[model samples]
Target: MPPRVLHFKSIYLNRSETFIDRLIRHLQRYDPIVATLFPKHYTENLPIYTPSGWWAWRRDCWLKQLNRTPRFLYGLCRRLQPALVHAHFGLDGYRLIGLARKTGLPLVVSFYGHDVSRLPDAAGWQRRYQRLALQGTRFIAATEAMKQQLLRLGFPETRIAVVRFGLDLHQFAFQARHQAGPRLLLVGRLVEKKGHAVALEAVARLHALGIEARLSCLGDGPLRNALKEKAQKLGIADRVLFYGEVTNEQVHDAYYTHDVLLVPSQTATDGDQEGLPNVLIEGLACGIPVIATRHAGIPELVQHESTGLLVPEGDAEALAAAILRLMETPGLVARLSYAGRLAVEQLHSLERMVGDVEAVYDDVLKCIP
Candidate 1:
């Protein structure tokens, strides 16, 4: 029989997250993946649960039986008899750990961003991660910084694998960057850590320096309204364009149109931080100069004017200065663009990343007694 893999996600598939979507699709290349999620009637491959509430109709049956998991989920796992249970997100693995124990199946959990950076510091999160770290078969961290962070939190270093989020470079066609009027682009959810407001402040500083530039934000979240208001208050409302909730094609188009990408990631008050934002890598892949703040794993990507420009987080003056420098020096921009693309092509290839993930699965399966 072919090796079947059961994938679990706390939420349904979100196409806006290109990396998540790409990872799911790539995993299917090696094995028959059955993505089980709380479905809103989505997908052609798998739709195990529906939004109509799995427990709304089965509460009485659940109370009678002392199973922590729903009857249908346990039955589904027994029938599939998957070789491995791969759960997305560090926190989401909390649910899968119990299921793995109940079924004697090994669970492999992948920690992206908040699950390692911020969630670990939250109330009761320490115990949760400790249990998963000790109980789960293996863990995957997208960046070495995150892996170290997990290790400091007492996660077994041997059990954690570092597989960065990679992209199919062929999909994002790169072109030479030329001198333009600083078309600055920022693509991420409108949140505190994303630094959308800081990007706007930087744009206003550019206007003050007599450098004409337009800023565009492509993503929507809880802070969209606040960011819009901040733009208006800065008096650069006319210079800024907010494209809330854009499609993947639209994001790619923006990368081609813009000269530079701004990623001023910072640590939130709640301790949330970045785990290598996909937009930064995507921008580099498109051959555009990226000016990301030196926060979290950003330094790993932007090596101080080597691959891309690095600036201090939340420093509007510094962010503005970097943007101005890129605009004034076309040669520097072109150099960084070429070097950045090469770095990604050589280091973060999609095929290599998928192979690394498959290696983890192979080792986990082989270790099972």
Candidate 2:
């Protein structure tokens, strides 16, 4: 019986599976069992979709979680006898602090983009995050920007670790792109921080320059209808295709098929931003030129005019220029293509990121009381 980690997520996204699936694949090699809190995902205080049915849950489950949350979670932890508990997001971690105390299991909380960015600005958010930092035994920051944000929130530096979201290198095959047209691809939810609206406006700007470019949006969110309306009004609706959501296979295929990938990320109105958009790395892996903004830790990967072009946030004009530059520049595509793949291997490879995570897990478990 090897160690176990009871991974907790308040609600999981049905579209893009959380980091749990990826982490489980890698961490399973050590014979650790990873379990989830919401046996199936729940949204808006309701079970979104559950094939097995919620009633199938053990009778003890309710008795464990009924009166006291910490006591209930502690009983579950003791019954499962996991060595540790790993929670993603600051809010979730804060919620489980009592469970950690009651169970005497080390808790590792990972702070992703919005968890450390926009979340801390919410009412009473700072105090909650600070409490989580103090109670959590270990912390993982997806990027340097996230690490800095954690420090600013009063988290001890010694407790924080950097482990980026990684991609399977072998999954994304690199094809040296010598020639392609201005066909732009936008990946991620159609949210303000993802800059999908800005990408559409940039496509319109490219149209104004007489460059008949086609833009494909891969992923959907609340802004879907509104963005579609804006594109129609801009008259670029004919050129832009909105793909609501897609499988990983489809997204990987699009990365290779598209001429260039646009990840024009920016700070949203609520102060939400990215740590480092994975699409930039995936585009690089597919050997396509990526045009992203200097938002958060993006510069850590997409260096301006080196691996890919970096544009100013919300500047459709600059983004348009970058799209055209990649199309017209000879040998430029090939150069960035090679450089980008190398960056992923050296920085964001799944194998290495998994090793880093395993190391943290091992270290935490070793010191457990």
Candidate 3:
């Protein structure tokens, strides 16, 4: 039997964090049970451990200041006897470092975007991360760009591993797009880093150019109202349909129905950025040609004019031009779609990511005395 692994995320899951669910689901060599502070979206009904009641939560908070594991968490470790703990986000890594130390288990932390870019600036988190850098056994980066970010945060060079976001190709299966006009799909939370406002402006620009471009936004966020207002201000509110949050199945259906996929991500005002948006991979895998910004790790996958089109981040005019180019050029869409699908299949397959992650687990566990 495979060794049990404790997978920690502050939240059991969220709509945008399907990658975490996929990782825990597809892992072959490790039996993963989730541990979270707040639990939601447990449709899989996996084994979950959480502190129950306000007293338990308050006590855990008091314990953290002393650099001690929450008593409940310590008990859970004693009961489960997981060989290692894998924290999904850097913030959780910092939160659980004490628990890991108490259990004497190797802790592997996956640093997804905002946790590296924005979270450290929150009050005392920088110092907390410095301690995490010292105590965490291994760090997983989704891109070389994120690896540099982790190094800047003081993670050990030898212990950092780059693992690309993986996709189930079968789920996002390829479909040849041959449509008229433009039907654009932008998937991701309506947030600053996602650059939804820029996408709105671009859609408006296309409308002004006598191009009938319609955009459908999947996923929701705190910025939804602001984005809707911006779309109204841009006079493209009708052209932009906000589906808010939808199921993974619905998103896959959108990819198949839509002709173009837009990922206009940029650095948020708070310094939040993307490691690599899995939406781009899903779009590519579904053979929907993508147009993205040259921001963070996006260029690593989009590859400008090869796998997909890339515009300068936050450049509405440039984004409009990219959309117009796609609208005018059918062969470009077919070429990019084929190349993008091939790229993901070669480098970002679910099997490839699972194998790489298990290798990281193996490398970390080898140091056990």
TM-score of each: 0.92, 0.90, 0.95
Clashes of 2: 1
Candidate 2 ranges beyond 4 A from true positions: 37-72
Pairs of residues clashing in candidate 2: 64-72
Residue 184, candidate 2: Cα error in Å is 0.8
Worst 10 residues of 3 by lDDT: 61-70
lDDT tens per residue, model 3, 50-120 = 78789997787676555455567777888889899898888777778778777789999998789899988
Candidates' RMSD to native = 3.0, 4.2, 1.8
Instruction: Report lDDT (CA) for all predictions.
Output: 0.80, 0.78, 0.87
Top-TM-score structure, candidate number: 3
Clashing pairs in 3: none
Model 2 per-residue lDDT tens digits across residues 265-352: 9999999988777677778977988889989999988888789889999999998888888888868887888888898888988887
Candidate numbers sorted by TM-score from highest down? 3, 1, 2
**What's the count of clashing pairs in each model shown?**
0, 1, 0
Q: Model 1: per-residue lDDT, tens digit, 280-347?
A: 88889889898999999888878988988888888999999888888888888888989989889976
Candidate 3 has a TM-score of 0.95
